[model samples]
Target chain A: MVENHPSQASKFKCEVKNLNFYYGSVRVLKDINLSVFSHQVTALIGPSGCGKTTLLRCFNRMHDLYPGNRYTGEIELDKINILAPWIDPIEVRMRIGMVFQKPNPFPKSIYENVAYGLRVRGQSQRSAIDETVEQALRNAALWDEVKDRLYDLAFNLSGGQQQRLCIARALATNPEMILFDEPTSALDPIATASIEELITQLKEKVTILIVTHSMQQAARISDRTAFMYLGEIIEFDRTQTIFSDPTHRKTQDYVNGRFG
Target chain B: MTIDNLHQLHRLIARNRFWEKIFIVFGILSLLVGIITLLALLIDMTIDGLPRLSWQFFTSFPSRKYEEAGILSAWVGTCLVILVTAIAAIPIGIASGIYLEEYAKKNWLGDIIEINVTNLAGIPSIIYGLLALGLFVEQLKLGRSILTAGLTLSLLVLPIVIVTTREAIRAIPNSIREAACALGASKWQTIWDHILPYSIGSILTGIIIGLARAVGETAPLITIGALTFIAFLPDSPFKSEFPYISFNWLQAEFTVMPIQMFNWVSRPDPEFQSNAAAAGVVLVFMTLAMNAIAIFIRYRLRRRIKW
Candidate 1:
């Protein structure tokens, strides 16, 4: 059993209490209880089919797109219950952005791709959108490479550039929190290193919850780490302790690469 | 080399080469058959009608005398009827397809609608003509006019339009829709901003092909009682007065190129036969032009959007 520390609770940006999720009566998340701190990076690390990505999706209700998926439990973002029936998924999504595993850029020009989020959210001024688009690209470390050819089609860029373009697109919306579901898994090692650098810098401004398969990536960038196994969190602690001296055997075994 | 080994190798090479030559000849003959038939018909039509095609043939009204008859009113009515058909069909067809692919729930009702659409596409064009004749002309009292003919042809091609639109929408990857939704876009916004834009090129190709089919239709218009001979053009859609637009010609009498050609071919006069061949050539050219435009636009858009 993990002890709850009361002093650290109030600083949380999001809290999941007794969360249970189901896909057509088959339980996928078993009584998940966790909290993510504000302006910090928390990484969720687990093997395949352990429900890490599933739990990440619950933050923004990405599973609502399909039928027969249900969630029962309290999920609070800044003291508001995001799982309440009255809350709109679209509204929740605007407050919290998500980057998918694959780099799915819109079939449009790079400028339009970054501007799409702002444009759909009702930002119509040309000058304002232009400034925000530039800022986002710069923040994602892609402005210098693509600034000259913003009007070109997004697919014309290489894979790494496209992924960074997606990041820029998410950042343009100015969300308080961003979710990363293995954002670098599809990228090469060089691209992955650049994205890790970007993520470390991003935590200064926004809260982040990243799901990753690489244990080293979690140890490298995250301020906190949660080791999940078979739909449950086995350990949650400071990244240093989780890597060096975890309280749970499962965490120690998995971290040392004995087995996934 | 041993005598037996040389003999076996020579027989094997000779047998394979002989079969390869046979297959090559067959493939060339199959391709040539279609090209030869088309070329023969084109040459025959040119020889019979090239001299008859002139500015007067394009501008003069149909006359009782074979020498004086032209297809001016027929071609004009063809344009007017096609315009009406496009206006009525494209929106409804595209909307139905979108609703089925994006909005409709996957249940028995949806299944029935889908199955029925496929079945409707396979039904004969003459059946749709009879349906339109009964519904639009007789029951709705639209009268045997341009509007009635347009409505009938729209029905004839509606199935084709719906089927093709659905195919185009299906070709889009689901990831694009999910990406749009993840960006905080609502259902309407996702469809309008992402789904519609990416699939629009394909939808347009389908619509143009459908419209081409509509233009070539003869039975539906005939069933709806379109006139065989029309000497006067319909009124202009533009007005010099207040409102500045008019649809007064929709309810007026009309005749199209195919009907005019049919009437000419049924005549006993050799000159009228030549006129019929000329009209057929023009109709074929129009269909080919529309198809060429569709192919060009589809190619351009496919290159632009790699996804």
Candidate 2:
């Protein structure tokens, strides 16, 4: 394990060390190192194109969708090297679920959308699938709104409900960590508040690494905040210290809105 | 000076709007011209063939007597040929399309395949007929039978099926694929469970349109030596005995509607000309029916999946 500072605990759900990433010939992330504490919300606050999304995608190897994207160094989840050559990307994804910025539910029924991950994990029993689907929807705070219309097409739901359904889909697999990529940026103020509440509740069950553009959101929900600029983390500290009195000049300027 | 400049800009905008209106008129004229030609042809076919459109004209087999001749054998042959073409082309075309769109990497091999498929789609149907004649008829020794004609038609339409299937698969958003992948679904499972279901309507539309084109094609079937005059039916697929379905039907000689119409149109008799026009009408109706079914299904699917 990497050495932790005396003030921080040593219990990390996942750890990244000397991580470097490139898309074709252009380096996007350079020599990144960070640790996600267990069952806590760690928010990555950065400007656009600062490699926050790239880092989240790297956690599940979502960059494998296309060719010419490369990664180096190590990302260990619970002491197991997730980036090891022998590890299957599909298996890694099951352990680390992701909710995208835009809510994308399949064009299937609401019940099918929640049950999809379970079905993919090879759960075939109808009774078990039904029970798990209900549990996931309840956890996502969507069961009461959608229980009567479980068979309706997912697109029939409102924007917030659809986002919640996407969360339910991600929750169905019961991953160790769930990554949220600007999950509330597309939502309205009310919807954003509800989703923020959901995130805080969710942190009790799974480690969350949320990338947000909103500094207020970071202050409100994140236990720890990492301020990133260019392609590097400028400061990693408690949310209170990062907001009230940062250690770095860059973090202080960013917190005071001097510049991105 | 500022007012003069604003006046000049207004004049330029007015001139552009005038030209746009002229182009719109030209486009409407061009569309009307095409639609008018089609309408004229349909009217002529109705006039020539409506009298011959009776129960007997559909039920009776072809004969030396023009009055006694019907499209039973030819229509049945067309249906059989289409069945074979669909069976041979649908799976192969959809699979190749999926591979090219979803699985294949952006490398030299993939580029070569894409370019070759585009080139294949441009080649004439008669060229495909010659290739099938050389390969299936002579080299494979399938002879000029029903199987040979069906296989030839399948080759003629394969490029269309593949091209349209690829287009349909490409229309699917990448988000759906990524969502499936993130849920721990394997590549094959993601494609089978999500991709195929979402795009099945378009794929079937492509297949039907391709089959419709194959049904109307004459040169390929004629070039492959399908008979124009056949009195007896092919062996029956069903029987009263055990193992009831028979494969012997495939080996029998067959005649399609186009070839039969071509034979009649080439004859000197006026009655034969009427018979040819009637057969043309039947072919047109069949093509229309297939297209209608495809359109209906595509419309329903579009409604069902709004996203």
- The residue pairs in collision within model 2 are none
TM-score for chain A in each prediction: 0.96, 0.95
TM-score of chain B of 1: 0.94
Residue-pair clashes per candidate: 0, 0
Q: Please state the error at residue B46 of candidate 1 in Å.
A: 2.7
Judged by TM-score, which candidate is best? 2
Q: Give all candidates' CA lDDT scores.
A: 0.89, 0.89
DockQ of each: 0.75, 0.80
Q: Which stretches of candidate 1 lie over 4 Å from their true place?
A: A1-9, B1-24
Interface RMSD of 1: 0.9
lDDT tens digits, residue span B152-232, model 1 = 888777777888888888888877877788889998999888888888888889888888988888888888788898889
Highest DockQ, which number? 2
TM-score of each: 0.93, 0.95
Off-target runs (Cα >4 Å) in candidate 2 are A1-10, B1-29
- The prediction achieving the highest lDDT against the true structure is 1
